[model samples]
Target chain A: MTHELLPSGIDLLDSALNGGFTKPSNFLLIGTPLSAKKEVGLILLNGGLERDEAAIYISTSNTAEEARSHWEDYGFKEQWEEEGRVKFVDCYSKMLSATVSDTPSIRRVPSILDYTKLSVAVNDWCTSYYLQNTPVRLMLDSLSAFLIYSSLQTVMRFLHIFLGQLRKQNALGFFLLEEGAHEIVTFNQLKTFSNGAIRVNEESNMMQLEGYRHGMNIPLPSAVVPKATAEASQVSCTPTK
Target chain B: MFKSNGQTTKVPTGISIVDTLLDGGMPNGDSFLIRAHPLADPLSMVIEFLHNQLKNGGVGVFLVNNKSPASVLEESAILKMGLRDFKRNGQLFFIDAYSALFGLRSNEAYFVEDPNNPVSVSKVVAQALSECSKKGKVFFVYDSLNTSIDEFGNAILAEANTWKRIAIAFNAILCFIYTEWNYPKDISEAVANLFSSIVDLITLERIVATQVVTVSKNEGTPVSKRMVPIKNAVTGGIKGYVPKILVTGPFHAGKTTLVHTLSTRAVSVQRMGTTVALDFGHVNHRGFTLDLFGTVGQPRFDPILERLGGEALGAILVVDSTKPEEFPRAKEMMHKAGVHGLPYVLAANKQDLPDALSVEEVKKKMNISDEVAIVGTVGTDKVSVVKVLDLLLDKILST
Candidate 1:
């Protein structure tokens, strides 16, 4: 079966994936502490926004404003926000006992403990965008927050159901998981269901493609060099044959 | 003598809007169900009610379910009545249900050892009600019904019924707060039906936080569908109102000019004398803080306009009076902004110009309905801008 490919926004990464990620595929981003995993996720989302597509960022770690500030550092905030191509599902503020009134593109759920509410909120947003016939890019900031609040079994069930829903909607999904935060068995269980998996280690400033479910054998790069500046323009992933 | 006509005496609730809706206030021997979202704080309304009752020389019994008595007192410190003083004077009492939840013994005047035991809690509440009723009027407030349901399951229905019976027997006023979306549909409906009236405190998702109260069920008279805005307690203990208003029109229609003139602090993103993105302003008028969002008028900027239009409670459509040909574009901009059904006023800008048209002429040329208000004004005039805002606010609140 032929699969449509969407650009991952990072030119080198796109080249590495032959073209880009397959349409409607789930990618697991496993990052160590201080990794540039969030920046990678933002690049993927920026690809959709640049094409005038819709993107939803579900942040379990920070407020929507803070998440947007992080995206601003990547130079993708103003244009996407102005065009209304980006939406935020904030699950952090209420946990801190802050009341977040809903905005046009931001929905705040009361608590992350109520995964049911979060599920319903995400389902509603994806379904609405799907009905609009718009391609959707979804990013779940981190799974570590969910694991901390709920049991491993519950998180697994939620991700399973959520990924299924995204697949049915034909939307791309990026899920970030912190390394060392969970058991290897738990990480393996999540990675097994993903179409692609990448591990980011910030201490060495290196990224490796651990696996790809499609069996597309792309040559692995020996090392990834880090750029000196923090600007999005300065960062580039160089491939070493 | 307080008159009673087969019904309990009506007392004044601190909130004027609620008192008007309830004819005077909640009647004695009655219970009211306040349906609210869990995140939405209905506790403020209860605090105001209790404060009024206490001020009126009535005794109050606060049934603390989820929050501890200390927490409740801390929150009510805004009342400025000295909760400790009231408790010492035997005018205020607390039935602590939260202490047992934390496995700690409560040191309050009335403590329920086992909150999960509905029978014991109901008995304690009934005894408190009887004692408090010995005073002129007794006011009872159940901090939450959802917590009780969580603890005792279906037994909460029986407990609520017992509370109703006790309230009627002692001629007391009772208020029960329930969070929506927490329980099953049938259970919430069943609980709502058990009350004499239901006041739904709804939070409208506008740019500015807007809360309105509506009566879904009332046994006395027909309820009004018109929403009453809830006054937020501002600093210095004054009630203040804040609402969002969208400013939009055709290209070069003086929208940015009007926003700047009216707002004390206005920010506009303009490129070469034309607004490219948006203009935002904040204005304080007549106890209301209006957050105005002015959208780019060009059709190419419709996406931004739609984003800015979301959650606007009202709108101001600015049109240059001399440019009658742009009326179609003005109407299109309003449509793009998604402010069709919301309260809006048409501002005929450049009224000081020689070719400026009158409000009636602009209305006729723009094909505006009579229901919509129109005001003729120059963009730079403070008086004219205030007039336009006042008219729009009046129409918004009236609606």
Candidate 2:
């Protein structure tokens, strides 16, 4: 019955987070424009991959090819994909393009409007990893896109079911939303469901950890960014409490 | 005047359940659109098409666009399609449209240098058809028309129209792998109308995800509208995949034991031999993977029953034969679990006990109808539990 927290791959916040995010909980990441929210997601996923855990990247805006290139640009090679340690649920491709093919590591969802199919793809990957007893960490890049495609009520209901499914498999979930894209009411509604949130400030490059026992506001390093990624000196092996 | 022969002039789809659904299969010179979800891969069905074609000595040509021609063959080989041998004997050919998009030089003989031009693609397809589709039931698989349509926009529909005419002229069975990406209604209807039949690869969301194939449209055959749950892999092309099966009854009725006995692998969330949460087990029964979910039989935990019963294909109600008084509770549990109306079989469990009532007595006590199968079983015994499962599976499949 002991709880475990996996690393978030962000070094400065680890000391305050007591290890990282809760072992199996829905996490809200507030991303200001030009913030490294997506990079944090990829790095957090990399943290799980380092532990031999399976990771699912739910890309709402980026195509599978574009997403993989982003992963490559960050430093990871195709080996992780070939090994099936990482998977992508690309919801962007088929919306505009007619003939997009899926690789073993990458799956394509029809569109955000078709949330059921999107949910199904996420469930399949979670269940696959769960059955193998492999811990899973899911990253849904930019929840704002979903809000644009759907009503606020619909997205809330989706998060309720989606985060619940991830919790069922003891999988951690990270959903990033642009800072000013949504109203305060909408943000508060989503925040109420999530175990905690990471508020990022693009102006100051600082992050305020909310809801954790020892949550604190910390100034992020210059190197913890999109271009440099986790490959730089920001890479941390800080163990969870 | 010659009377109707009664013999089918139809060609088998190489899928047993699909063939059954179509009452033998599509007639020659017919086209079937195999629409799939973005997450699902029904390419195996196409591989099975070629595999079956080889057996019947029918020639086939697969148009590749999404992926490389070599990858297509490699995937085919995984589905046990010995296409290399067929290629050696000149019975199989691949229209390498995938390589042309990337400008990669392909070693394929029937390669399309530019897939952007619909006419060039059609000409290549026509030439390949002329070469191999001379005799027997010729097969032409547009590996997927989605890619060509994506590149050429709605203009590819005209090309598809042209191919449809050519397929009929050649008297071939045309199979198109069209993954539905939520296109506009007009375009979707245009695509649907072009085919004589449409087979959709659906993602059925259950406790675990399952892929099911159903014939949505057919011009000739009487559609059964049965969802054939399909599993895809490198080894098995397309096999029967039954994802979720439920086992529920009153407390101490041995529901968990029945699940353990039935599944190849099983685990129970329990405290002191009492299931507190749930029991999960899986068994490959009759070429289909049956996921067994055993609900916590305690009435206090009845709240979890509804969640456990989510999209269960079928259920097996395990009741203690010695305790007929508890039959009402067992029946009530089904309703509480939301699996009361689903295809279910009553397992008169603990039948090995000397004081156990007969199956008929158990049925009478429960006031169950004749259609609801009642099978005598010992919960701990694998054979007994398996018999109960088989009965439930029969009820589900026969649906």
Candidate 3:
């Protein structure tokens, strides 16, 4: 299988992101609670799915069924139910099912280092279906929720190993984060570990996207604004507060 | 038949209307003592009087040195009674005593555990009255003469007497003694000795019930009284015809998302999955605007969100169709809304997938009151979300 950087295929978005996503690069997406960061992740995943790319979803908080239901509004229900390429690895459910507390236990709940135990189980199941089907994209919905099950350091260590496995397979990756990480020390650690980073902020009515990439910076227009040509400068478009 | 004292005398009724209600103006020069409570509406009378004098282009020098001058001015501004055009004409001189009236390091005096020195009180009052008397026909208003009694002790009466002597000497200065009527016996006696007997015009501020009755007293003189009914506008905060919709339920019940879907704009202080705090949104429906608050499902949340809705609400209890177990929590919110007699609607949200419970199943899980109108919804769909509000309207209209 050949590894290729994935394009969301949304022309404006692809241009803003500098010719689409870079393979094996971990990108950080930050936004106000309801500023639509998760929605962007779902949109990108859906675009990949449309291209027939097998995607793996790792949920730290929500259940697989819940995530599936949320994306139904974005037109992913039928595509997901039909092909099992879009699957969920629910850590929350697994921990609950095993009745093992990451804390107060004789043995600490396994961190990302222990993710191999899970991936091995996943690898075995995938082999039963098809031996060599490599996932094209992997998304960790949120890391903050995972901290509830394990310490930030433990989770980060686990993520380093788990994400290394995805990078070895050349899978595109992105992490969804809440704005509260502005105070947490772990967010900076993630930023240092990632190749690129983007921040989303909603000022009044429009969502603004800004980021630094490879020493070059890109400033995207409001999430819902259209770029106009120089000739159309007479016709101005800006959201009014 | 009284001796012709060569002094021009005027008394402040502390009210503009009563001043107008008393014709062109009252006597100026001599002090007219007004007795009333600290919270008494003496301000309304004083402002209306000043407003009338102001509207007539009657330029008068006013000396005010209250720490809360801004708030007092704001209250007067809202009443539309005092010195509306005084600032524009640049005639109202405000004396902020925040830095110098007291003998302390600064005029920033909050409470007086011990009474103040009479000398300092006399100096501030003397300075204020002298400035107010500079222009001949000036309506000299000393807001509350008694405030200084705590700091000035009985020396305030001597100061008032000295003020009387100066006005007699000027023959054009008008002195008005403004203070709470039922003051401490000592202070009242001291103030009375200086201004009461010499008062040419007396206006008794009467608040009998909500009605304001002004009685102008004279010794063996014909009675001249005026009664005005004061109507209060909406106090505390601005209220409108907009309906308040409170969205609340168990954790992960989609209440915040439902509000965002319904509102034109939204603000949520959320963490990862569950709401660590509250969410807010403003929705303008057909002709009504709704202020929506999505509170956390905890029991302590009731008081904060309840006050946010003020009087009543048009609440919506959001439920996740996929999570029937959360229905009991939603019902508890419904009961609280019922206590306010606020009409509410149930939003059976997340009804897009096969795993989601049907509307009938959700209704059975919740303690659906006869008052609530339940509707199935997909919050992500704008049109479907508006339909839930439509049901809320029908519920409100029926109730």
Candidate 4:
């Protein structure tokens, strides 16, 4: 059976995966402390944004303002935000008791502990963008924050539903997790639901690619994080027979 | 029959601009709403009003909702007005409502058992007025209607209505301070309509939080509607002040564009498509006169930057978003302008470009601390330009 491939915005990784990860796939990014995990997520979103594809960043760790500042740092423009091609589901500010005013591109949830509210906000964003008939990039900054706040069983349940929705909408999903933060059994359980996974070692500054049910498990070359290229970040998914 | 004096029987609010706006002073036996933002404190205005009333030989009654009577007294003493002396003379009194919120009984001259109970609060105010009114025209100050609304819910409207009736019946000047931008639109509108006159204490951002007083509405008088900048007087009350802002950045970072965008009248000394010397613009925002000076971006124009940087209350450092390499130059320009340790905002320009870096990237490359505000801007985008200015002003005021 043939599967569509979506570029991960990293040249070596894209070439190693025989073009990219299969479309409609959920990819988990496991990184050690102070690794380039966030950079990878940004590259992926910028990849979609460069192609003018709609993208949504569900931020649990940073306020929407902080996220926007990061996006602009990587050479991304605000035109995409103004045009409604980019959106942020902010679940961080209210934790600090700061009021999050509603805007077109941002939906501020009352708290990160409110899994139901976060899911609703993400679902609403997906529903609207799904109608656009273009591929979408959905990034959850880090799952560890969620795990810290919620029970393992509860977070697993939420991700099961969330990943299922991403697959249904043909959206590319990136879920970030901290290495060694959870047990091996927890990793195995999450791995079962994800189609592919990449682990980043801050000490070695290298990323290892692994497949769950597919081939292309070869370790790629040293990942040279691209230095702020506008076009290099614009990788897209193309269907193949 | 009410004796008609040559001038209206009015109580000066202590804010000279506010008094001038109200056609000399707030008319006696009338209620006025002082709308302000929650972060913007109007307590100084209230305290000044009370001091003015005391000076005029009129008794003052302050219904405290958000602050403790002790805090009020401390703040009043800062103005050199001894609240204890006024209380001893039966010229000043406080009805503490904040203590009830904390489930504590206050030892103030008067206390409300239930701040949410409008009838009980009204009864206390009525009894106090009976005792105080004999002295002269009483000044009734409800420190804030918004705080009361928060505690008592919609009952505050009815409570205000009762206070209005009492003000009329007792021939006292009633002032209701409502924090602006904190209530629901419909509720704020409904409350605003209840007042015969509205004194809007608008907080404008510069290097520091400056205020302006405007009489938006006055039933019996011709309101000036003039924006008058207000400053805290050394002794007491608030006076008038102006703010000057400096706009400086690296070459081709859009400093000229920003100055042009914010300035009502902008003059630029440009030769060969670049600012050769400097750019000057003037903006009169909400009664505050802002003199905006735009420094030339070229490194060769360091002398001009230094000259414009002096006496600037605040500064804005504009940098090109797509050019991270230029951020160092931007920082250098800021230091050369003598804006070190001074309040300033970073304007990340060219954000409309596809190659533009995010504000975070610029901050990282420039080594800017998180505390310093960095706002995105696109040339010719009015909203983006205004947002940058507002952030710069907010940072200035906050510092």
Candidate 5:
């Protein structure tokens, strides 16, 4: 039996998913900087806002105000910010602030195990942000940052831990990462770990999105994850009169 | 009240709820930023203070000095403070200075956009505060200190000194200074500590409890200290403490059934019967709430479950006392939970089934060396279920 789906505020995207993202599932969105990956994440996230579900966006790049202003253009800025359903956790700051000053213990660091620990830390941080009986939709803007800081084996373990928490909470979440960072093996492993994933790309200097056989594969505008180009078929570029 | 007494005793009209938070009310002219965790009601507290002033029919005047554009400031104000009738009282005036932040136009006030030009920023703010303070009953808020920290850089000290000077001159100038946020715990703590020492009052809103507002931190040596728990008034909605516990065991060890048996409300979102994803439920016993999360016995899924259920204080590692051969995985799960210093219990489930490993045999394989308790249980029976919970609670209470 299907339950109520939260709309991402982008009409085409909401309708594309037959409403919105299914609750209690983990999905991935992959693209480069300015890929509109964050935009798509915000759409799903803002949908939760409409439902009065608390949504948290862990930004590895964008500022909270910048993210708010971008959504303001679509008339969701106030609802997302004021009513307090949406939040941003800047992981960039968290990681940057972590003191790597401890004397480096040179014991054999199990690449997979180390990554798992980092993942646990990330999950702990996310869990603490949750307040209210508000159903939550969590978005981690860039997993590549996690990967860059830790080993690839660790990244996989991290993903496993990260995805595991979301599933346990029955929350809808997305882990964003860059396309070229990992090899095919890691990609396949992540795809298997996730219930759904979408591949976003920039082609012919315009943005385009494709399905990864896990998440909604629809190419509709509202369902589109941002890519590098602003001229993606999904977004209207005409100046307002 | 505007006697020639050199003291500027202009107290902020803190709303009843918030005034109660500040121990009667904030002193007339102290400068402090509203410290907030990722999601604290800083704006609400400010508005409530305004509401209290209006409700009491006090003659207080507020001048909102915006360093950003007027449109941006107005839009944000509208979003935060809805245009309700209570907000329409005639004591508030808004000064649009957003243009000043971007090197734009200003009338009679020189804009301060350059960090190197602290002289200009300081001069402009000082002039505005001075003019506003002359109105007898006035409260000053800088909206945010984070922006000033950005524009002032290391010169934040100069900006702070400016506040110190303002407070000394007009003791009623309660300056709200906001610092830029990056969520670097150390940085935020350092800023909080620094501000706490200098400011007469410091209150921080840390979003720790789920959907509940409990005072997280207060450091200003108030006349009294009290923590207020704020909840949704209408729905009485709350995301109260739901401890996340993990249940694991060998294949078909009644792990799923155990969760269903013990849980008051439960659901499984696993793709495969072997729990490919995860399981969730809530356990209620005599007022304590335990949220149980379970995973299948497969090795590949074990780490994922362990990592997700990190730093748990309560874990129930289930073992099928009925299956002697599948005891190893149960022991392994117990060992993992122990590594994180989590207090756990052993549930020797399916005790009624024939050829069941006795509780002793199951505990031996698990090396019941420590004082951790073990209980023989039939996942379906309520009597057996309550016993298991009692054991878990005992472990929790003891710890």
Candidate 6:
């Protein structure tokens, strides 16, 4: 079936997937240690930036500042980030006990082990971006860190709720996974939840997308959580323009 | 209004809702921990707290641990907190627990040679606090409890208790910037019990992550535990808090766009970009933080309108400028939402479309009262949408 997809900016992969990824979609990029999964993830991330889409990077392996600079090195626009269009949820910095002060462009996540906080961080970013009526693209640098820190069941539970929220919000999400990082059960379990996965070959750097246009459709876990706040000194009346 | 720890006057953080929530601001010599999620800005809160303290002729003592004092001062400059000025004027003092140990230096008067030395760090912090409080009302903040813990294990919590006592002794309010780093549960609970009030920076998933602040442990008066939406630091602080304001209209009337355009951060409980559930957003505008709730326009969703408009301070009724026929439907939805008596503004949206009508024309079609301001708006234009909110807020504030 044809779909209006956001191109991954990789011509070969774009053609293989019939243009690119569908909106309201979540796709996993699986590749071995030396494969191009990270490269592919960054390209899509950068592509989203070029298209003026709000992009969020959940970096478990690197500090938000590091992820940002690395993305910048790949020619991502600085203005988008400066303007709040690009945000990073760092599960890396504070994990290393590096005390970077709070700022808008980046947020600190306490630990990789705390998947709940990590999910909430992304949820916050996606919501913040959704205010403007633009598509949001979320890229997790690699899922290996999460798998390493947490059980597959926990990571799967996180992804199910996380990706389901993205789909509901019509966001396009790409989660990178290092092949062989976990048991085959990890990959098999993820496939059941994801719409499909794009796998890059170990030696050839070639790619092929697996089918599951509509994932297993497991019902997303439901939990009701409530609302937000902004700064407040005084509310002296200002006449309207 | 509520006194604890024998503090003098209540010191305002300048954020209106918080002051009200804290019952006219945190009292001097009172201690509270702002336990924030990594995404929340405790620094901005600290800056605003210190700024108000300085402005009111009180003194501020900053015990730096997370970052160097120089870096703290340098970074806070973005908010124009005037730390340097306050320091020069003798109203602000910095105890360098981070800089001297790292071989860097700020022009701070007090410095600890070894930050890891609990007694030495305690001595320097206490000395800075004692010196600053002697001047008058004092606001002391431990830049971070999380980093202090990393630098000196679970002992930081013990140290925090000591500082709290010292601040209380001097009648100076103490604040600690603590971030949750998956510390031990018992220690986390212990840290919570150490403070009189806790301002938690929590993220709630209303389909999207929305940063919220809740106040608890406030003794003497009832703390509603009001969950307020927060924005990225605005120069002076959070301007004001309007808990709820409704954005109602017919489906496809640009209600979502209007909400999006006006909010600093927003999320719609939607499917495929259509607000099937509801839209929520926060905007710090014209010296107020307005929480906008955009309702699902379909009649099937009308049942939820009453809840959506439950406590809304005011409302914005969005309508398609070109389609006068749907005007009644928009009003009907608001009526069903039980917001008839509320002061609201009419947003004549889609004004950018070729067939759209003018603001006056939209007003005429809806037969809306003259008291309700009518604004012509293109949802894509932030200016026009803000104007709509501004008019509604003006009416809301007046009432």
**Which candidate leads in TM-score?**
2
What does candidate 3 score on TM? 0.31
| After superposition, candidate 2 runs with Cα above 4 Å error | A1-221, A224-241, B1-8, B205-208, B221-224, B250-287, B291-311, B335-338, B349-361, B369-371, B375-391
> Over the stretch A1-241, how does candidate 1's per-residue lDDT look in tens digits?
2367988776656766778888788888878765778777887788788877889999998998889888887657676766767888988765444334668788776555445346556766787777687788999998888787455665675676668667877889999999888999989888877887877666555556657523322221222223522432344555435
For the predicted complex of model 6, DockQ is 0.07
Cα lDDT of model 3 by residue, A204-237, tens digit: 3322343433323222233322332232223322
Candidate 5: which stretches are off by over 4 Å? A1-199, A204-241, B1-12, B51-120, B150-154, B175-186, B193-225, B231-399
Best by lDDT: 2
Candidate 3 lDDT tens digits, B1-399: 012233423443434334443342354444455443332334445555555555654444343333233433554555655453575565554443322332323322122212234555456545654655564344555554544543345666676677666665554334443543244577655565555322222212221112233434322132355333232332311112233567777777777778888888999987676676788888766544567777787666666655554434467778889987777766766666442367777788889978998888887777566656778888778887788888876665344
**Candidates' RMSD to native:** 10.5, 9.7, 28.4, 19.9, 17.4, 15.5
TM-score of each: 0.59, 0.66, 0.31, 0.42, 0.40, 0.55
DockQ-best of 1 and 4: 1
**Positional deviation of residue A181's Cα in model 2 after best superposition, in angstroms:** 24
lDDT-wise, the better of 5 and 6 is: 6
Kindly list the per-residue Cα lDDT of model 5 for residues B243-335, writing each as its tens digit.
Answer: 667776776777778888888899986665667766777886654567788776777766675565664557777787877677776777666
Off by over 4 Å in 6: A1-40, A44-125, A132-135, A138-241, B1-9, B97-120, B134-137, B149-153, B180-185, B201-203, B208-214, B220-222, B227-233, B247-332, B335-399
The TM-score measured for candidate 2 stands at 0.66
Tell how far residue B57 is off in model 2, in angstroms. 2.3
Give the interface RMSD values of the models in order: 9.4, 9.9, 35.1, 16.8, 16.4, 8.5
TM-score of chain B of 3: 0.42
| Reference-based lDDT, each prediction | 0.75, 0.76, 0.53, 0.73, 0.53, 0.73
- Candidate 4: pairs in clash: A69-B360, A72-B357, A72-B358, A73-B358, A73-B361, A75-B356, A75-B357, B36-B180, B207-B396
Model 2 lDDT at residue B190: 78
Spell out the clash pairs found in candidate 1.
none
| Candidate 4 C-alpha lDDT tens digits along A1-241 | 2367877676756766767767788888888766777777777787777777888888888998898897776656889889898899988765544333558899876555445346556766776777676678888888888777455665675676667657766788988998888999888888888887877655544566667423333222222344323333453322222
lDDT value, candidate 1, whole model: 0.75
